[model samples]
Target: MIQYFRFLIISLLFVSCTDETATAEFAKGADVSWLPQMEATGYEFKDEEGNKADVLQLLKDRGMNSVRLRVFVNPSSDPRSGHCSQEETVDLALRAKEMGMDVMINFHYSDSWADPGKQHKPEAWEDLSFKELKEKVYEHTFEVVSAVKAGGVTPKWVQVGNEIPGGMLWPEGSTDNWDQLGQLLNAGYEATKAVDDNIQVIIHVDEGDNNEKFVHFYDNASEQQVKYDIIGLSYYPYWVEKDYTETIDNLAFNLKDMVKRYDKDVMIVEVGGLYDQVENTKNLLEATIKAVRDVPDNRGLGVMYWEPQGEKSWSGYSLSAWQEDGTPSPALDAFKN
Candidate 1:
């Protein structure tokens, strides 16, 4: 596989491609679905009378080709409290499919949010050793995928774990323990393949524009023999503490190199900017679109505005704003080419 920075220069040489040539290569996708917590806070897919809401139709209408839903095995709190169980997610997935949108399942492998800072295993698997954990991961993954399939919705992509920068499932398979992490990832990969070899498996990480982190994570995963089909990144200019343009440029360049080196398709599975700051939001969104559009050919699979219209907005984690009666923000229009 191609290592990012080492081959950066070579990628720079072929960066200039005509728009027609670029579009013919990499198509676009989105990760519009929020996690369980966000969903429960008031982002209802069903109306008070139990009818389908227009959000699904709106996404399809707005040109979003895909919706990425996160699945949590189980949670200490109520399952619906921002941590999606198999049932809720599948229901959502089926709806997305019905709306003619592709779906991607992101297995957080934890009961709550799993990112660079935290990864808390579900209570049920907290005691498992490496081997037991691997088997458990496979069993859990298979069950989730199976549930989605049985519900009459097939996912186009499945992420093995969500932002596994410091490892997943905790203790035994944490990032510091590469051997365990490799086994953990493989468990999910195996399940995905068993269910359907065609569903692309993604290994996701945060800090999309950070070349060093991207290089380190991918290289370590390669050394551990972790299998994945897509390079998934989470990019948010508002959250990232850096000059937005430089960060985006670094990310675009890194993505091109990652595709060239890893031989995998790239997806900005999770991305968003603030809508409250109207001017800044517009600028940030434009920069983001340009960065994604800049990637060579099929390598840049485009981005999803992560919960752009989430309830109450990004200021708080509530789902109130996405309700039908709620006014849509200018953020939605930012993605238009």
Candidate 2:
């Protein structure tokens, strides 16, 4: 009985710490999952003084208090499109934590990019039966999560699957089959909690400005008994080819609506603007951060820039916040406040 009471006290303390973190920190950072690969290729990051610097430290100095890292199964070596294996992600998470930054682990459940457009299962998972698929989901999630903790950093949040509004693991776990999707999601959720109930689970989707998308997905997820602690979103104005001014209002409204309707904290887990439009991007980020901070009860968790350190020259991706000269763009200063 004494041991049981002692355990209960520790458990409650852990839960309390998790809640305090959500209310205390407004997560502001980038999904710099490609940092390891970029550094391996000899790309250097510079501070404002043009002196070589560690990008993580530069981001922290700019007011970022968190980092989001994505994990893949057996991945390819492509710097832009592949190689976020568990080991790589765990290492990155350790680095971020060592720098006093909170970490979010994103499970893509695929060997490549998994988004609203496509969610291909990893090659090893493709042929499994539905039952086997769910087990794999749990197993994979558990392993990576346990590994991250063992590496000395417990991720504050774990996204069950990336941009999964249409569902993940393909036909068996697609939106067309919400029941199956829910089960698969719960498998990931359960796995996450099995590692540590203190870790919050996130369900991510794209098109943050589209309220209909949120309603359609979350409504169905609710009916299907999908369990989650947070709603994660990806908002990229450059991808939509529109100036952020056009949809910033909608995004703000959606943020409030999701919190009220679902009673869950919400986060702009991924967002970015064109590297060339630094001023406009800065404005967009400032507005985005304000919108989140304005949410009642602070249910609006935070906003994270996707790949802000990914230089366009090296990534061939134009939406990063890094300048061509290898310095971080002023746009990142939005987090300065």
Candidate 3:
């Protein structure tokens, strides 16, 4: 009996240690979902030495160890506006992985952008009943995740929806109908796990500083038994039109509260500052990373710049960290050390 108990104890310890090792690595990187379209349209990427190279290599050389790619449902081929379709997303994921970086797959569930302001159900899904809608959600999620995994890299994180503060899929899947919204979210979770049970699922919301928003959504999620493994947040000072210093403390507080209250890991999955304010943006990035690292128990998993490589000149996104002359802003150096 003593020998049998010893064997069992060793087995249990091995299992526990393995789980910890699986998630022990910290992720820091950017989302360059627009790279394919950007390169195709002649946006040259140069490294610090002014030598043109793959943008992923430049990013990896600058303290990034992971990559986040956004996947849209059925996207148009518009070079500037659209084209994050599954094929594009999968190709990017493979490139990042080939560069020895971990991957995070973000699902928008829309043909275009999906945020708090808009969560348009895919045009194909607009007419389906709520029950059918859930099925489509599962089918779509499973197909995409399976394709990504089959492409030689299993994503470490998969966001069910991007910045979904108002709930996803609208009308029926809106926050106004928690029961149906919960079901829709669960469809995503179930389908994701069906593909790879180990991939962590994230329920992302914008406004990391607003503990009230997290409490409200997560509270209802808990009540509805929404199956998710992480709380993903997006913090943008530019959008709020305020200095990050104003809410940095609140963001830190929310990170601490989330881990303890939700009993799950958290990640500042999206964060970026304006390109013009290099110093302020660098300080904000450093402070934001420090806040996540300060979370007790290592529940803070990662920080990803929304689109650091999407330079303003080419992408017209003012918050990018790339210079018009094809170089990264010093702000990205915050990830170092």
TM-score-based ranking, best first?
Answer: 3, 2, 1
lDDT for each residue of candidate 2 in 209-284, tens digit (9 for 90 to 100): 9999999999999998898999998898777778889999989999999999999999999998889988999999
Off by over 4 Å in 2: 1-23
Higher-lDDT candidate among 1 and 3?
3
Question: How many residue pairs clash (N, CA or C atoms closer than 3 angstroms) in each of the candidate models, in the order given?
Answer: 11, 0, 0
- Candidate 2 lands at a TM-score of 0.93
Q: Top model by lDDT, which number?
A: 2
Q: Please give the lDDT score for candidate 2.
A: 0.93
| All-Cα superposition RMSD per candidate | 9.3, 5.3, 3.5
Residue 90 local lDDT, model 1: 89
